[model samples]
Target: MATSGGVDVGAAVIDCGSFLIRGGLAGEDSPRALVPSAIGTRSGKNDVLGHSLWGLPELVDQVVDVYDPMAGLQAIPKWDVMKKVVDHVLSKHLMVSSKETPLILVEPSYMWGVNGRAAAAELVFEGMGLKSFFIARGPVMAAFSAGRSTSLVVDVGHQGAFATAVFEGYALEKSKQTSVLGGRALSDYTYQVANEKAGQNGIRARYELPSMSGATTEKESKAEGSNGVVDSTAAVSKDTAGSEEKEKPKDGSQDVEMEVKEEAVPAAPPGEVSKVKPTTVEAPPPAPGAVVPKEGVAKTFSLDSKKAFYRMQIVHDLKQSALSIREIIETPDPEANGGGPAQTATAAAVVAGSKVKREPRPTVYTLPDGTELDMGQEICERIPESLFDPRLLSDSKIPGIESARSLHRLAYEAASACDIDVRRELFGGLVLSGGCSLFPGVAERFQREVAAITPQMFKLRMVSPSLRQDRASAPWVGGSILGSLGTFQQMWMSKQEYDEHGAMGINRKCP
Candidate 1:
């Protein structure tokens, strides 16, 4: 997604999850192009309510050399944390940017309240003394990134993953878009496993802190266990005052205390009973299974220990189910058993239009609390015959698959309407742009199964964007590039035009 001018276009895109806010300036094609879309900040300043106290702040050593600070951000009230992230990017990027430009802010569809995302984008730019334009439709931006005449764009983010079809440069309004329980769900899952591992080791319960590191950072540190010295750059956390938490060795053995903590795990008062109950809630207890690599002890993330982190591995693979569930539950049909989901053209619309999805069936994972984390059929997958056309989920009784199929049915039907068009002309390339595209077999699955659920009239060929790394940003970057066209003004409504015509009128003006 290249821009038109001799004048460089500078913009920052932010993903504000409940736990973390990721801000990244558009970068050139490179290995780690998007840089994990994360930011890190101190305990008090990063959060407004100080909820961050629930989680440990990045260690001083972690901060000074942290390539991307947000990676350490714990799962907290994401919008607030995200705002801080936006402010951080504004300040940090502004120091090096030209204020003479408009900073385009691409936001998630569910940002703040209704219409709040656009306003937030406006405010972010205005506060920075830069004119602002909002790119709220992530799927549309991704479609723009596709730059093809016709294609499908699937965007999987940390918090959500969705799919959209683009035809003639615009998203297909009626296409089925899915919102799978995303990275946050994965974090929650990992948190559970870490806790379970801890409890299994007889470490009594305490509050668990939200934790994750973009593999870019944590993976390197995990690998460096081969080195003689502990990577001093790893983030540090403080345990409760009483517990004398020992270092977890890589070989699953406790050889010695290689690292030192300033604060000892405090012990309870003499004969005082511990309030931290082993049985409390379905969620995992903090640090339950977390292997705190002692500063000096060599370490490796154990395979058994790594299952908690399954969310990241499957983010790209199983996210369609999540989105499908969000779509169905959000459908407008009053008779649906559940409370209706958010109402938008996206009605699970990842791209141009919207979709209908049943409430996701709970994905049941054995949680520490003698309970199972119910992620639903939408979230859990077991080598389905067709990832696109899942039989178990499509039960007419179960709203999750029923409704998801409903969305696909609608999109496929519409696609059938365009049967006369050649797929070679329609989807010259299948563009897979999203965090989930990072998953293995996504392309194969789509080609094999997506058509099964659709009408048989059309032949499908798959195409995807070349830039797979910073996929979350690919669509926005692509749209930004197209928007650079001199003729684009013909389709754009001026602020004055929008003001003159009310919302209805503005809708008429939209490109």
Candidate 2:
């Protein structure tokens, strides 16, 4: 939605993910600005020419690099970096003042505690100086986006994948289970695979750590499988140990931290700018130990874009592998159940012993370096196999997801954990959202696996966004739909209320 610089503009809906930030007006069909949840910077100054520079290598100049504030299960660890990213979204990209416009933000389901939500509210009301705001759970928002009020939301996003059961627009906090095997895990696995391939050919592949370069004095490396060649100009990796450690319930026990209350909370009340901004500013030459690549010096480094493609391939492989683990169950037709012509035909086919013919489907990807890599069915099928049966992978321990559960198990467990009265509804309304859910055959495989384990009395129905639907931005869409509602305005925890109650009141007003 286009908006002129003015006061009291329409409410802005922002879905802040660990990977991407999708935001726009409350009534817009889609987010007008979709940017990477990253901050680009150069030394001596925090000026990142572009607000979103995930894949635009050409637009990049100088010793510029991007850093993700929320790299793991811990979201929004860097308050300053997040502030800059959000400020750019509101002031520059949206072209409206955030201080005036009411805002609705979608947060990850896992980050639903005093620490995450309260800190976010502080950022919005106190930090951004916004008057009104609303916080919605990522999976709940995803369920809303899928046109359902109650659903078992299986969202596979950038940071991780989660199975959250939402009943009547309320998230079943106890039923929410997450896995570390998300986009990052897939990307890291891809890097490992690529590094192994490069090693076999006696080639060196150095992955430019997006967050480590540019602004910092030294490059930090986290390369797996690649030779651990320490650069003299590089600093020790800044990544903290156990960054991916998730606060999961002990022994996979279903425990509800917060009870779902059925009551309406009182409604409180609702960057870059220019292209000539010099992609690379004039600066003094690098210091002796500066990590920035020497000017005019050609370097052979793998781009993040190429690695993203590998992640997609891995996602597809996971879908195929999960599907392969299941045995197809054929149900008898109604006519076949009774003595009829269909039964006669079925008998004949069984007698004939006919076999179904199938062929392997190869996925081909073109790398950024203008090279084509064709992943065979066997290899692609093996990639995602680790998700279901971790024993298949040598390094089964994934960060964040200490105890990885299969997609089928996650959904089934989420559904089973719900109240008996809502179990059928949860099972029937299985909503799949997020980037990995877009992979082909994922929904079908999930349906099959869930059906196999589901009791005979219960039927399994899986819901997924259409091909044309923006699955990755579903949470933002839900926030948009929600923020545009006349009733939704009442739910906002106003600046007046925040002034009186402070951050602790967020749980009461917004919850």
Candidate 3:
């Protein structure tokens, strides 16, 4: 509800990612709604909307096709379905008429040539019948959120990661780089690890259905938790101890995989695994007359597409709650006495050996059904480590896993691709944004890793917001600040302008 020129500037900011869509009024500190960028549909029925599309027990009961419209921050494939999602957010969540409210939409920097910007402009100006609209790139807005007009913005989002060089509020088109190592990739890796451990330790995973009598209201479901989905840890439990054998899916389609195409990058030498003995959590011995589940019991259940989607959500929760970047500190080699060249080689080996001995403490995470997953330090640490070393994913079947570069490499390459005059500024002002970057120690680790490859003359600094919400919704917050400024009123592309020059005209006005 900000005002410009004494007129109410009721502009709304919508920043959509592969996993979530953040929306709110201008001038707000945080987003008012964070809906899933997905929709559910059944033949001859109304489309299921918002959090309900997550296949929550109280929201959806039957099998349905859950389509994610914004996957990998790419161009919209199903414009018809995407239109419904936008309409729902405006009318249901924001509670404003599309015709009256001006809009600022945030897109990825690489989306321009693919007609993503033009299509979005069409959707807002023609499809939604909005009075005014503007399109902003994700990395540029992320820089603005950190109070920097020029910075190297590394956005680690749900589907993919991007490093873009922004100079004076303009993103360098050639300097933008992308990778498949992101939140979803980490979640998939976590899921794979959990499945392997479940097979070995008699653990099980199943969907816990809510009771009809205790179902939450629609309004309650919408506000149940952040990111639209209800809290998975607090979900109802119906699983019990029982004997069952492991069952594998017939088609292997149940395995979680990223939607992007696969590409290959040269693999790095594998690191040595730690030899430290780790403790494992075991279930208590069954009481008299109690049935004890046998070891290696999978208790596999048939999951429809909808249920598979929900299972992925559970894995995502585990990644967010349990996974963290393992801080790697280089230690001086003790064997490096003033000696022959062979001694220096031996010293380097000793340093590498020391890294294998530092293991993180194990953490136990309880599932919705009260099943405890005792994640060993190696697994907990390695999951986030994959972001920094894509070679860790070399064993997995995910497409493009072999081709993905570590985040630091991506940042260095992007900045190097920029003009020589601005490379120093880009390196000095590195901004971390996106939900995946919220992992503890990410900022410190990124800055340290990037500095190792950077020129000695340039000083590097990491700009990360202290609040978790601020980093996760950085792009939306930036748009909110820009939309509410009185001096920025003339920047909006009005309806008349769209009619005069068509959707492509938005590129000139917004840029």
Against the reference, the lDDT scores of all candidates come to: 0.35, 0.53, 0.62
TM-score of each: 0.49, 0.69, 0.74
Tell me the RMSD of model 3 versus the true structure. 13.1
lDDT of 2 by residue, 173-193 (tens): 888787766655654554455
C-alpha RMSD for every candidate:
16.4, 14.9, 13.1
User: Which 10 successive residues of model 2 have the least lDDT summed?
Assistant: 248-257
Sort the candidates on TM-score, descending order.
Answer: 3, 2, 1
Residue range with the least summed lDDT across 10 consecutive positions in model 1: 248-257
Pitting candidate 2 against candidate 3, the one with the higher lDDT is 3
After best superposition, candidate 1 residue 434: deviation in angstroms? 1.6
Q: What are the per-residue Cα lDDT tens digits for candidate 1 across 184-253?
A: 3333433433334434442221222122332134532452355322332242322422343222111100
Candidate number that wins on TM-score, 1 or 3: 3
Name the top TM-score candidate: 3
lDDT of 3 by residue, 406-433 (tens): 8889999999998778988887788888
Residue range with the least summed lDDT across 10 consecutive positions in model 3: 245-254
- What lDDT is obtained when candidate 1 is compared to the true structure? 0.35
Q: Which stretches of candidate 3 lie over 4 Å from their true place?
A: 1-9, 54-56, 109-114, 200-303, 328-362
